[model samples]
Target chain A: DVKVTQSSRYLVKRTGEKVFLECVQDMDHENMFWYRQDPGLGLRLIYFSYDVKMKEKGDIPEGYSVSREKKERFSLILESASTNQTSMYLCAARRMMNTEAFFGQGTRLTVV
Target chain B: GIQVEQSPPDLILQEGANSTLRCNFSDSVNNLQWFHQNPWGQLINLFYIPSGTKQNGRLSATTVATERYSLLYISSSQTTDSGVYFCAGRNQAGTALIFGKGTTLSVSS
Candidate 1:
């Protein structure tokens, strides 16, 4: 079974604070992604990494950045958290040629 | 980027009932998947049908790439099946999946 693990399940931060969400996968997948889920918007992609040191901006990449220094780990960074940034963040990983993606339990972020 | 849409934004059913969900995409796709997001917000992959039919237990899915659409069927629904169902598609660009708004399913005993 493939396992995708997020570093935190819940987080709270004050406005203008820096925040980091970490994800790790044990399956050695080549693609990793970050998405934010909202009530009516469904899941919108924030960022994705196809390989170590490679990153691409997704539909809603504003106010967020990503790091992929290693193949097994991907990190999402918020330059300065704002209340509007609060959301359910999800991390997923998939093999290069595989169509199915394995996701981690999401992190519910709260910005006050 | 491909546009994905799901039908019946919400659904309610009783135990042992059956339901079918549909997903329509705007362009040709290289990958398509169905996901069930449980109440606790854990996403479980139900199907990876780029263009074919697959089944598991009481659940099944069919995708027609030529038609740019897919369908998910759930039979004998149970209370534990209550949650959100999402269908996503990946276009020829090989980008991440573009998700639909999802169908919220409520099953009552």
Candidate 2:
């Protein structure tokens, strides 16, 4: 079975603070993604990495950045957190194109 | 980017009842997937049906790629099945999947 693990289950940060969410996958997938889930917005992509050092901005990439220094790990960084940034963050990995993506248990972020 | 929409934004059912959920996409897709997000917020991959039909246990899914739509069927629903169901699709040029707003399912005993 594929396993995607996130660094935290819940996090609270003060305004303007830096936040980092880490994700690791054991399946050696080539694509990794970060998404934020809101009540009415569903899951909006924040950022995605197709290969090491290669990143692309998704629909809602503002206020968020991602790092993929290695194939197995992907990290999402908030330049400076704000209350509006609070949401359930999810990490997913897919083996390649045209395949099912596996997701990690989301991290509920609360920016105060 | 492809646009995905799911029907019956919310559904309520009793145990042993069956239900069907629908997903419609704005364009043709190379990959389509179904996911069940449990109450605890875990996205569980239910099916990777880009086309045709696939079944696992009491849950089955069918994707008509040509028609740009998909359907998910849950039979003999249980209380544990209460959660949100999401359908996502990816066009040939994109690596990321665009998801629908999801259908919230509530099953009572």
Candidate 3:
């Protein structure tokens, strides 16, 4: 079975503070993604990493960045947390050419 | 970029009833899948049907790539099945799955 794990299930941060959310997968997938889910707006991509040291911005990457230092781990960083950034963040990992992806439980970040 | 749209944004059903959820995309896709997000926010993959149909237990999914749409059917619905159903697709390489807003299903005893 594929397993994706997030470092934290919930987090609270003050405005302008830096926040980091970590995600790890045990399946050795090459692709990892970060997305934020909000009411009515659904899930919007924040960033994604295809390989170690390689990352790409998604639809909503303006306030976020990502890093992939190893094949199994990906991290999402909010340079400066803002109140509007409070939302449920999800981390997903998948094989390079596979259609199926595994997701972590999610990190509900509350920016105060 | 591809756009995905799910039908019947919200659905309420009684136990033992059946229902079908629809997903429509704006562009051709290399792959498509259906996922059930449980009440606890865990996403369970239902099917990876780019085309044709596939079934698992009480659930079945049909995807018509040519028409850019997919359908997921739940039989003899149970309260445990109450959750949100999402359809996602890959339209471009090196891009993540573009997901539909989803269909929220609520099952009552």
Best by lDDT: 2
Writing each residue's lDDT as its tens digit, candidate 2 over A32-69 gives: 99999999889999999998999999999999989999
Q: Any idea what lDDT model 3 has?
A: 0.89
Off by over 4 Å in 3: none
**Each prediction's TM-score against the native?**
0.98, 0.98, 0.97
Q: Candidate 3, clashing residue pairs? A: none
Q: Candidate 1, which segments miss by more than 4 Å at Cα? A: none
Per-residue lDDT for A14-61 in model 1, tens only? 999999999999988999999999987789999989999999999899
Candidate 3 chain B minimal-lDDT segment of 10 residues: B90-99
Q: lDDT tens string, model 3, A29-103?
A: 888999889889988889988888999899999888888889999999999999999999999988875567778
**Weakest lDDT window of 10 consecutive positions for candidate 2 chain A:** A93-102
Q: What is the lDDT of residue A107 in candidate 2?
A: 98
Off by over 4 Å in 2: none
**How far in Å is the alpha carbon of B86 misplaced in model 3?**
0.7
Docking class of 1: medium
TM-score, chain B, predicted structure 2: 0.97
